[model samples]
Target: MRIFVLFVLALSFFGCSTKVPCNCKCPKCPKDESKVFVYNEPEITVYKEPQQLSKAQVYYKKQVSYVRKKAAPYWGEKAQVADKFNYVKYAKDFKARTIINFQNGVIRVETTDTANPLRTLKEVIASTLLNTQNPETVDLFSSRHTIHVGEPFLFNRVKDHDGEPIRWVWRANRYAQHLIDTGLKKDAIKTSTGVKKRYYVTFKMKQDNYSNSSELNYASIVKKQAKRFGLEPALIFALIETESHFNQFATSAIPAYGLMQVVPHSAGRDAWEFLTQRPGQPTRNYLFDARNNIEMGSAYVHILFNRYLSDVKNPENRELCVIAAYNTGSGNVLRSFHKNKDIAVSKINRLSPDALYKHLRQKLPYKETRDYIKKVTSAKKHYL
Candidate 1:
């Protein structure tokens, strides 16, 4: 019994004295199986497109500069450059230019020198009919006497409403019917100027009904991509509305492309790498495609929410960070509170989401980013 007791005590002593492996799960002595938080950030490189403009782009730029200097046309006050969907064709032979603002759905045709302006105008109309992607039903804005191709739903009263004589009016209507026969019903006409003279025509693609609403138009794609990326469809919708006003071919001075206006060098590169596990710059054409734009944009949002700003404890707070970050960046979001990332994260975690939102709104570096957060958050409600 004594030996047995001695053996038991020895066992206890051994158990106490022997350095047992720590199972406390502290940071300093992490277990072999424990996960170590590692950020696998992709190495970003400068994005450069092939230094060649298509023939169409060359003309578009030339005409845009001329129009900016002379006509003072409204291509949406925000549009800096002609987007992909916005067509501007300059016929060097005719010295005529045709411009389309897809965002505002306005079309304009002007010529400094064209012998037969009517023929040139007809050619421009024909091209639009052939190539332009027609909206389901667009309300045409124009003067009375121009070619009225499609079925007119709502007619804007022409201020001066003067046209050629009765025979000319009849001929114009018949000619417009001929245009309709040639496949141009979706987007019709309102001519601001005469078909004769130094012809100038301006027409706007107006929204008449729910059938042509941009929200309903892109709802399916937004829902699909949002589901794929674990994002709110409302959030995606709001972002698109804010970024491009649902203009899929939207471009920015930063040279960001498509509906979400993704900058290829930063957000686009990161998101593409995340999705493909490869490094490559997305072409303007690729980003212009609605699916590609939303996919990449949503992927970047996922990165902002789940990866870069994941340290933020509150989901709502994290989203605020994401909204600001989408406009600026994660680094900027952190810097809004504290320059040091670790301290900023700690501060963010401690604050209520509402407090964090206030802090962000007040302290964000750029007024644009500050305004952007407000816009996105407010716009999100509509989608919801």
Candidate 2:
């Protein structure tokens, strides 16, 4: 019994000992796994490691950093710091404010209000970029920039004879602004100085060869001539339209010259000859001279008005008769009036200038004459 008791005591002591070795051991924990460990006499917890940045993100960050550094001088210190930390945010905000996007190899901007901050920024960027001697290529995202090369710019102003001012406002493209700044603004006028003077005899000629001729000029000229001859200005304008298409130097293949398409037979040779006969000159110049053209044309219209006044009492009818005579010759127009005299005056009166032109076109012998009447009548309405 004593030997068995001693053996049991030995077995219990061996089983309780921490130094004893075992055949199986537990698997080690992964580094990523959350585990508690002792460090510097304090308990610490371990977590999974963070991932490194991607290649694309790294490239973007580097690009943003470079741009920020380059823009520092222009944007000042605060912007530079913001760009360094949050370039995408800064760029997006700037774009929104300026209505301009300066990313993706182009700069785009828009402004409904001229005073827009973004518009100002765009101007600054454009000025700065263009002023550089070796500036990088820039693409503006607006249609205004499309006119920068070889496109014409138009400017127009109208004023009444009574000193009333009329304002004409036009939005200019970038090209137009550049042209104005570079002294190319005068190049866009379509009318010559001499032609414009004849059209607007009373109005002061401010600029030479400025392309525009206003309707007011035509109206005023017509008014002055019509008042002198006791005729309607509308009729005068209509004739002028048919004769010259409002061109001062308009000449016809049939030896007619000027805005009135005057022949050399009655006016004499040379522009000066018609007004003041020079010695040794037998005939007036065949070419259309602006002043001579208007004067001769107006005189012819006045004569026709007087000749047809007895049959055509109304100023409108007299004018139409004059235009018909100008197109079909006085003999043919007189014959047509005699043949159609029995027709109701109201029926003839209802005929519009266009209708009369169409009727005259059918009766006219020459195709050119017929077309001439139509063109003149059409132009008359346009100018009026």
Candidate 3:
């Protein structure tokens, strides 16, 4: 009874959905032919084919950068100084480009050397921080320079609009860094002439105009774009809502941008190329733009349905694959079918769409991916 009441509320909220033709069933394309989903699709404008790199290149670059970031000092970085470094004797010269440990406190001597020279006792300690496996040592070293303020300076407390005393708060959220799938990267990375894998220092987003209901034209835009690519508008809306709640300027912990949470370094690259007919590359400016974000995001779904999940025939099952592929990559979605390399199309065909859905629910290794699938499916009904 509760489920029925909720269904009624959802239908009233999003209105009735028009059934659209979907190509999700598991089947191989006929020999000497292509399975073109539509006949009258608009021609994609190719301003220029963007430059892209080999998957191996993208993977190597990402791994190197991750190694560098692990070595660098960032506030969020955590570490407990291993035994020897924590108790190292002070060298004779404290001013050299090495950290000097004394009975009183510690001081870091800065250097501009590009290459890591673990010559000093400090560098030995730094090596631990540089290793991706170790947690950050920022907390270990934060109190090294223990500066005791002799005097306390007091200021008048500030009040808020509600006549309450205001307090300041800060938070930290660890992002998934340098994906561990070496096997996936070499195949997943799609590079081109103008499209380069994007890198970001921070993933922060400011939403000054987010609350203005009048400012959103996302639904209409999503409807138009989805129809152009033969997708249900409600599904797109559900994805956007679940991804960023339709926030035009939303960003994720992975630093994925806009409503789709498209990560420029990965799937975002593929989606961009598909839409503009250009080499997929990273763009800080365009990624936040509402139109481009949705277009690329929708384009990704098209690729997944047509390419990765092509064998998945049922519309409902296809949608499930599309949703999972959006969150965890299409390759990972495929792997969920059978962890072994010998995943046959026949095996996929034998299972009902419901069986495939359950298989995904149970098989995906990541809790995040599993939760994402459920949320997107549940919210889809709301938009429908």
lDDT by residue for model 3 (1-384), tens: 000111111111111111212243422211223333221221111111122223323543454344233433321122112121122111112111223221122323232222332233233222211212111212221222212122100001112223332122110111112111111121111222222221112111112333122123466778878887778887787777667665444443344556676767555655655445465555634765667778878877776687556676677777887887677655456556654322623456677888877887888756777888888888787666
Best by lDDT: 1
Candidate 2: lDDT of 248? Answer: 43
Instruction: Tell me the spans in candidate 2 whose CA falls farther than 4 Å from its real position.
Output: 1-220, 266-289, 336-358
C-alpha lDDT of residue 296 in model 3: 78
lDDT of 3 at 368: 72
C-alpha RMSD of candidate 1: 17.5
Candidate 1 overall lDDT versus native: 0.55
Output the lDDT of residue 242, model 3.
68
Q: Candidate 2's residue-wise lDDT over 29-97, tens digit each? A: 112222222111110000011111133234435544554444333333322221111111122222211
User: Each candidate's TM vs. the true structure?
Assistant: 0.62, 0.36, 0.46
Query: Backbone clashes per model, in order?
Result: 4, 11, 26
Write candidate 1's Cα lDDT for 26-45 as tens digits. Answer: 23221344223212221131
In TM-score terms, candidate 1 sits at 0.62
Candidate 1 colliding pairs, count? 4
Query: What does the lDDT read for residue 332 in candidate 1?
Result: 59
Candidate 3 minimal-lDDT segment of 10 residues: 170-179
